[model samples]
Target: MTSPTTRSRTAAACMAVLLAGLAIGAAPAALAGTEDDAGLEQTVEAGEEVVTEDAVVTDGHVDVGPRFLDDEWTMLARDDREVPSVWRDPARTVLHLGDAAVLPAPDGPDYEFLGVEPGTPLHVVPQTQTPDVVWLGWNTQDPRVVDSVEQGATLRLDGLDGPGELFVFLQEGVTGPPNVLWDSGEPLPQELWMEVNTHVHANWVFTEPGIYRLDVTTLADLADGTQAEDESTLVFAVGQDTDPAQALAAVAADTTSDTASDTADEQTADGAASSDASPAADPATEVTDAPEAGAPSSDSGGSAMLVWGAALAAVVLLLVVVGRVLRARRARDAADQATGDAS
Candidate 1:
């Protein structure tokens, strides 16, 4: 026979072993569940990526382009936690730092890095000597449509502001208001854009395929520490040609359709909301549907004419009674006078 203490110890050892096995067996499941939960949370967050809607200005003079691809992009005022808003058409396209990005410039392809903002002297260009490092935070920026480029097709780049010299400086060579083709090194008018200024609108068409470096620089008046000085360079790129123009057009069309759809949706939503908001009618209360637009309503005019005719009849009867009373009095007075004269 085993001693009581020994038996108790044995039982305790077995329980401990069982518990340890259970813990080891459950560990993977618990960890996997945790990972799944975390993944679900990530999916939810990613799915909720907030794309800003079209910004409409009451002033009527607001930039109109996919906020991401807009050459007339504006920098967010410093001190705001929200990153400066940028928009792109091809929503699926990804942008990388030092990758072809557009910026404010004085001449050539310019990037508007900063405008009138507090603390940063109004219109002053921040020093960015390193052209490659100057980047717009496009970590979340994706084109509205993805993979919309085709081989051998050209894209038109219209710059906001004015007609001035436009240059596309690549790591390979320099192409400007006079565009140089990447393949044969020959130039085409399709690639060339007229020189424009800050107020003039200019457009350029790029028809060659392959990865190309984009460097745009332009000068703007900046009151720098007392004297006006500084030029800003804007850089961006066009990637492997895969029907970029068509894709851009498609994206634009999609955006337009989306806008119209949104408007329709909003109208629908408004109508629904208005209908829903209407006060519930009491079962005892009656509703009369109004007539259609521009059509005469239910012979109301005829009813009014009938009422006017009745009023006119009453007036004519009153007038006839007064005239008869006056005539009777006049005839009686004349006979009485003649009788007195005869007596």
Candidate 2:
């Protein structure tokens, strides 16, 4: 018969082992390496692309995933020590707030002259000179902060509203946010935009067009320990009207009356016809077609699998530890009884 003392030791040992296993199991899901993991309990394993870390399905139901932007204004600071040689190297047109346009892209690289995927935010802003790249930028006032004009400034986009995702990126020369920015509270790899001067060119894409008001913030860390900060609102009039306020109202109404959903359906219904529709005679004229497909919501089975696997592994470890402890305890107890009997 096992003594109470032996039973107690065995119980304590099993509990300790089980607790240790659980601690290890929970650590990865809670800890984060990138901004995309900021809010998620996601455990990103090695070799996974950032964009693919979206909502996934576990068992026919879609599990929640990370987000690119917080629904409200999320302030991000750029601490890059290196500044570009020219703010606008191959001088492109300046964009102003209240500027609107259907972004142009030839679906290829050489973004400077060659249009890329229509995902750049800079294309729709009104600017100093007519931007060869974005038609709406021409005839629009430059919206950049005045003080930072000469010293150089790092451009960052702030705030968000409306439907669809905003994709901004640079292929060769630079790097910035390329994932879909939705209102959902998912983690962003880098919540802040890359530091850019007027010389910087990037790809900006918007899935839906209407009036979009984005707060643009510029920060330049000078040599003298002075931080130059400037901010302004950029209003985009996309699709039908040019009036920022009216455009806003139109989209708001659409959202309120469920017109955003309606518009999406209309676009889908006419996808074939719209696909065949010729490019706008004047690129400035707002063109409406099906928005490009982005990362579709998938099963979070990958993450779920990892989580469940960890849990199962932990349980297995606990059972193994418990079994080993019990066996050892029995051996010791048998030896102790044999010694007592022999004496």
Runs of candidate 1 with Cα error greater than 4 angstroms are 1-151, 159-166, 169-303
TM-score of 2: 0.28
Badly placed stretches (over 4 Å) of model 2 are 1-152, 173-198, 241-343
How well does model 1 score by local distance difference test?
0.29
lDDT per model vs. reference: 0.29, 0.35
Winning candidate number (lDDT): 2
Alpha-carbon RMSD of each model: 28.6, 37.7
State the lDDT of candidate 2 residue by residue for 226-251, as single tens digits. 56565533334444433444644543
What is the lDDT for 314 in model 2? 100
Worst 10-residue lDDT window for candidate 2 reads: 56-65
lDDT of each residue in 115-145, candidate 1, tens digit only: 2111211111011111332212111111211
TM-score of model 1 relative to the true fold?
0.29
